[model samples]
Target: MKEKKRILLSLFRKKSNMFLLGILFFLLFFMLVSVSIYNTSRDTISAIERTYGTSFSIGLTPDKNDMNQWEDRAIEGMDSPVRTYIGPNVDEAMVRRITEEVEGITDYEAGSRADVMLYEYELVPGYHAWSYNYFTTHEHHLPYDPEETKNMMYITYTYHTRNSCHFDQFYNGAFRLTQGRHITPDDAFKCIISENFAKRNHLKLGDTLKIDLHSLNVRAKYPIESLGSVETEIVGFFELTYQQTVTQYTEEIDILENWVITDNEAGRALDEIIGRPYYLSASQFFVENPAELDEVMEQVRQLDWIDWKYYELVKDDGLYSQAVKPLRTLKIIMAVCLVVIVTSGVLLLMLVILHSMKRRKREAGILMSLGITGKEIRKQFLGEHLALGLTAFFFALIVSLAVTPGIGNQIYGAVNKGGEQKVYTEKEIEAAIARGENSKVAEMSRNQRTGVEPPKELTTRVEVKTALLVFAMMLLIVYYSVNEAIKKTLKLEPIRVLSMIE
Candidate 1:
C-alpha cells in the first residue's frame, strides 16, 4: 500500500504529466457542471411547455357584404324583425367530429350564451344604465317597445357548456372555484354562479335555481312566453380573481357578475324547450403537442365534411407561444451546448491520456525491470488520475454551487423579460389597449392563460446525486483511457521499451 501510494505521488511530481492531467481534470469538471445546468434548465422549460398547451378557436367567418351592418332576424309575433346580431357558431356535430377524428386534439369545450331570466333574482348592476334609462339616454331606435324591453337587461344570462373543466376561463386562473365543483359532462341540469351572485341571491349548492328562457318576440322581450323555463341545481360558485372594470361602452349584458355557468345537459334541455338552432358561440380545441399544431390544423382543414365558406379556425396560441417561445429557444441552446461539451470532453480526455502514456513508456520499462507487474503499473496510473479528478471535482462543486444559480437566473430572467411576465388585470389591460397595442390582448386577458405564470427566475444547485453522476462518468472515462493506454505499452517486451527513445 505504501509503495502504491509512493508511485501515485511520484506520478504527479512530474510537472509535464501533472500539468496535462490537471488540465484534463478541470476540463472534465467544467463539463460536468455544464451538463448539470443544462439538465436543470431543460426541465424548467419542459414544465412550462406542459403547463401552456397550444389551442385554437373555431367560429363563423363573417360575410363581406355584412360589413358595418347588424343582421336582423324575424320574431314569431312581431311587426318587424328585431336586430338579433348573432355571429356564426360552430355546429355540435362538427366539434364532435373534429375532436374525435383529429389525432393531436387532447381536449375541447363548446360554449354559448343564452338570453334568460332568473325566476326571482335580478342581475348584479352592470355599466349600462337601467334598461328604461338606456333607451331614453342612448336614442337607440329599435323595433321592440322600450316599455316591453325595460327589464330585458335586468335578467340573468347563462354561459352554457357541456364540460366546464375545459373552458378557457376556468382552465386559466381568471375564474377560481370557491365552493362545490365544476360542472362536468356527467352533470345534468347543474350550474355554477359567481360567488357574489350566490351571496347576493342567498343561494348555495343543491339549491334549485329556475331560469326562464327569453322570448324573441319584439314586443315580449322580457317574458318567458316563447322558449319556456328550465330548473337547474346550483353545483358550484366561482370568484373572479381580478376586478372586471367596465369600460365606457360596456353594457349591462356584457358584465360577468350576472352570468351563470350551466352544464351540457341543461343546454340540451333548453334546446329541447326553445327548439333553437344547435350552434355554439365558441369552441376551443387543445393540441396534445404544441409543435404538431400546424400539422393537426392542416389535417382538420382538409376534412371533406367541414364547410370552409362559413366556418374558420383561428389559432389561439398567443399565451402559449408568448410564454414558451423563450423557454424553447433556451432549451435548444442548452441541449446543443450539452452535446458539444460532453462530446469534446470525452475526446479531449482520451487524447490527453494517450499522449501522456507515450511519454511514460521508458518509465513503464524501468518499473517492469524493477519487478513491477503491468497490472500494478496500470493501477498506479489509475490512482493518480482518480486522486486528481476527485480533488478537481471538489473545487468544481464549490464553484458551481456559487455560479450556476446566477447563470440559471440570468437565463430565466431574460426569458421572463421577453415574454408576458405578469397577467394583466382588466384595468391594466385597458391601459395597454389605450396604448394602441393589439386589442385582441384585452379579449385574451378576459379568457385564456396558464393556471400559474412561469417562474420568475430559475435556480440551479449542484446536488449530491448530480455530483455522484459526474464522479461516476469521470471514473468510467479515466478507467477506459488508462486501460487502453497501458494495454498498448504492455504489448511490448521490457528490453524493447527500455531501449526505445522517449
Candidate 2:
C-alpha cells in the first residue's frame, strides 16, 4: 500500500500528467452533457410527431367558368360558395376502396356538410357590437328588421352554415383522444368538440346543440330553421394548439367551439332531415407505410367514378417529414459535436505529453543509468494515464445524470408556452354563432382543451454501452499520448546519458 501511494504521488507530481488528467476530465464532462442534450431534443421531437399524425391535404381545383363574380354587389353581399366546385364530392365507398387496394393502408374516413347557421350563446356587453359585425360579415348576414332586430340582438346569433364532410380512420392515427371517446363507426348523432370550442361556450360532454339551415329564397320571413340537431357526447377533445398556431397561423380560431365531427350515419341523417343533396366532401386514405403512398394514389385516380380532372391524391408525407426533421437534425449535430470533442481532446493530450517529455529529460537520463528499458518506461506511462482517463470519465457520467432533467424541463416549458396562441376550430366558430355570443371567439379559443398532464422528468441512466464507449476512447487517447512521450524521452543513448552526468 505504501509503495503504491509513493508511485501515485510520483505520477501526479509531474505537471504535464496533472494537466493532461484535467483536460481528460473536462473532455468527458462536455461530451456527456452534449449527449444528454441530444437525447432530450430527440425525445421532444418524437412527442410532437406522435401527437400530430402524419398527413397532407389534396387540393381540388374548380373549373374557371364556375367562379362566382361579385360584379354588381359588395364583397360581403355577394353570394358565393366558400369552396369552388371541385369534384362530385368524395364518398365512403371511394375512401374504403382506395384503402383496400393499397398495401399497408390502415384506415380511412370522409365527411361533408352544407351551408348552415351556427348560433352563438351570449357575449359580454363591452365587445358585443364588434362581435356582431364580425359574425355578420364572416359568418352569415343578419337581416335587418325594425321590429325584430331588438329581439334578435340577444347573446345568440346565427351564421351561415358551411358544408363539410370528414372520415376518420381510427382514434390512434392523426387523432389522439384527450377526453372521452373517439367517434366510432357506431356513433351516428355523436360529435367530438375541440378544446377551444368547449371553453368558449362553457360546453361540456353530453350537450345537445342545434344548427339552422337557411333557404336561398329572399322573401322568406324566417330565414333560419333547425335543419338537424347534434347530441354531442364529448368522448374526447384535443389541443389544436400546435396545428392551429404553427401550421395554419390562424391564431384566432377556436377548434372545439367552431368545428364539429360526426360519422357517416349522422351525415346521412342530416341529409334526410335537410332534404338537400349531401355533397361529397374530401376523401382520405390512411396508409401505414409511406413508401407505398404513390402507388396507392395512382390506383385511386384510376377508379371509374373518380373525377380525374377535379380530384388529386393527397398523402401525409409532408407532415411526417416535418415531424422527423428535428430528430434528424439533432442526430447530425450530436455526431459533429462528438467528433470535434474527441479530436480536440486527443490533440490537447498530445501537447501536454510533448511538454512533459521536455521537462523529464533528466529523469529519463537517470532511469537509463539505472538500467530501465525504454519499453518498460513506456508501459508505466501508459498505465498511469489510462487510470487517470478512466477516473475522469466516471466523474463525468455522475454529473450528467443530474443535469439532463433540468435541460429537458426547460425544453418542455418553451414548447408549451410557444403554443399558447388561439386555435380556431370550425365547431367553435359554429358554436359561437349558435350561442349568439360571437364576441372575440378567436381570443377565447387559446385555452388548452385536454389539459395534457405534465411529462415526468426523465431519469437519465448512465447506459453501459455509452460508458464503455467513453472508457475505450479515453484509453486510446491516453495510450497514444503517453507512448509517444516515452519514445521521444528515451531516444538518447544510455552511454551518452551517463557521460553527460559525469
Candidate 3:
C-alpha cells in the first residue's frame, strides 16, 4: 500500500506528463462545457417552437371566376390546390363536418371579411358635422389616392364575423373592453368597436347608430349613389391592451385600432341589404398535431362536399418553421460535434494513456510483485487521472466563464450555414425611409433574414450542477481510456519490465 502511494505521487510529480495531461484535460473540459450550454439552449428553443407552433392551420381561398367547378365529380384541383367556397349558411355545418371526419383535426373555425363604407350621422353627442370622408382622408389614411376614395358613399371600417376562433383584437388579447361586453352569437345586431374609433367619434355602448354600407365590388356593378344604409347597436368598446406592430407611420390608420366586429347574422344582414351578394367566407382548419397536417389535408381534399378546382389549401405554419430553423440547425451541429468529440476524445486519450503506461511499466510490475493486485494497480491509475481530471475541470470552468459567450456566438453562426446574420441593404432602408413607408421597410428588410429565427446568444455559468455533470462525464471518459492501459500493464512480467527500464 505504501509503495502504491509512492508510485502514485511520483507519477504525478513528473512535470512533463502532468503538463501534457493538463492541456488535454483543459480541452476536454471545454468541450464538455460547450456541449452543456448548447444542449440546454437547444432544448429551451425547441420547447418554445413547440409551444407556439403546435397548431397548424389550413386555409382555403375561393375561386369565384370559375363557377362550373362545384360538381361532385373529380375536381380539377383535388391533387393540387383548388379555390373553394361555402354555402351561404353552411359555414358552421361545414366546420362540424370537418371536425367530425378528420381524425387529427383538433379545432375548426370559419370567418368572413368585408370592407364596409360605414357612414353615421351624430356618431357622438357633440362633435363637428364635418363630412365622414375627412376622417378617412386625414386620420384613417387609406392606402389609396384621394380621387380613388372620392365619391365613396360610406365611412369605413373593416367588418368581421367570426365563426369558431376570434383571432381579432379582443380575442387575441390585443385589447380588452373598457365598458360593455364582446358581441356573441346570442346577441342580435351587436358590435364591438375600437377605443380609438370610439374616442374619435365619442361613441358608446348601446348607441343605435345608422351607417351607409356599400361594398366596392357591388359599387362596380351598381351606381355608388344607390348604396343602402344599415343600423347596428354597439355592445362593447375595447381599449388597446398592448402596443402592436407598427405597419405605417400614420398610427390612427392602423386597421386593428379602428376595426369593428359584429356577429355573423348582423354582418350577413348587412351584406344582403339592397340585393348584395351573400359572401362565401373561408374556413380555417386547425390540427393539434401538426405532424399529421398532410394526412388531414388529404382527408379534407377527399371530402365529397368540397370542390377542389377553386379552393387552394395554404399552410399557416411558416412562422413556426422560420422560428425553429436556427435552433434546430444548431442542435444538429451540436449532436454531431458531441459524437466527434467523444469518439476522438476516446481515441486521443487512449494514445496518451498508452504512452504513460510505457513509462510506468516497471513501476506497475514492481507493485504487482510486491503483492498489490492488478485491480489495485488499475485503481491507482484511475485515481491519479481522476485527480487530474478534477483539476482540469476547475480551470476549464474558470476559462469558460470568460469565453463562453463569444464561443456560443461562433457556434451559432457556424451552424446557421452562413445565414446567421440578417441581411439588410443600406440603400433599401434609406429608400424606404425616404418613401415614408413603414410596411415597405419591413418588406425590404425581410428580403433576406436568417431563414430561421436566430437564436439568442447562450449565457453560460460555472454552476455546481454543470460542474458536477461535466466532472462526472470526464471521469467516465478517463476510466475508459485507462481501461486499455490497465490491460497492457497487468500482462507485463516484472522481470521483463525491469529489464526494459534498465
User: Against the true structure, whose lDDT is highest?
Assistant: 1
lDDT of candidates 1 onward, in order: 0.71, 0.54, 0.60
Q: Over all chains combined, what TM-score does candidate 2 have?
A: 0.63
Pick the winner on lDDT between candidates 1 and 2.
1
* Candidate 1 structure, TM-score to reference: 0.63
How do the residues 136-164 of candidate 3 rate in per-residue lDDT, one tens digit apiece?
A: 45756444544444434233454555531
RMSD of each: 7.4, 8.5, 7.9
lDDT of 1 by residue, 144-258 (tens): 6676655555565687887886666676666888899988767788899888888888888999888777665224434334347789999889887766655433445556767
Of candidate 2, the 10-residue stretch with the lowest lDDT total is 157-166
Error of 2 at 120 (Å): 11
Give candidate 2's root-mean-square deviation (CA, Å): 8.5
Q: What is the TM-score of each predicted model, taking all chains together?
A: 0.63, 0.63, 0.68
Q: Report how far residue 403 has shifted in candidate 2, in Å.
A: 3.0
Q: What is the lDDT of candidate 3?
A: 0.60
Off by over 4 Å in 1: 1-3, 15-34, 37-157, 172-174, 184-187, 200-231, 241-258, 269-274, 279-327, 347-361, 368-375, 394-410, 421-452, 455-465, 480-502
Q: For model 2, what is the alpha-carbon lDDT of residue 159?
A: 16
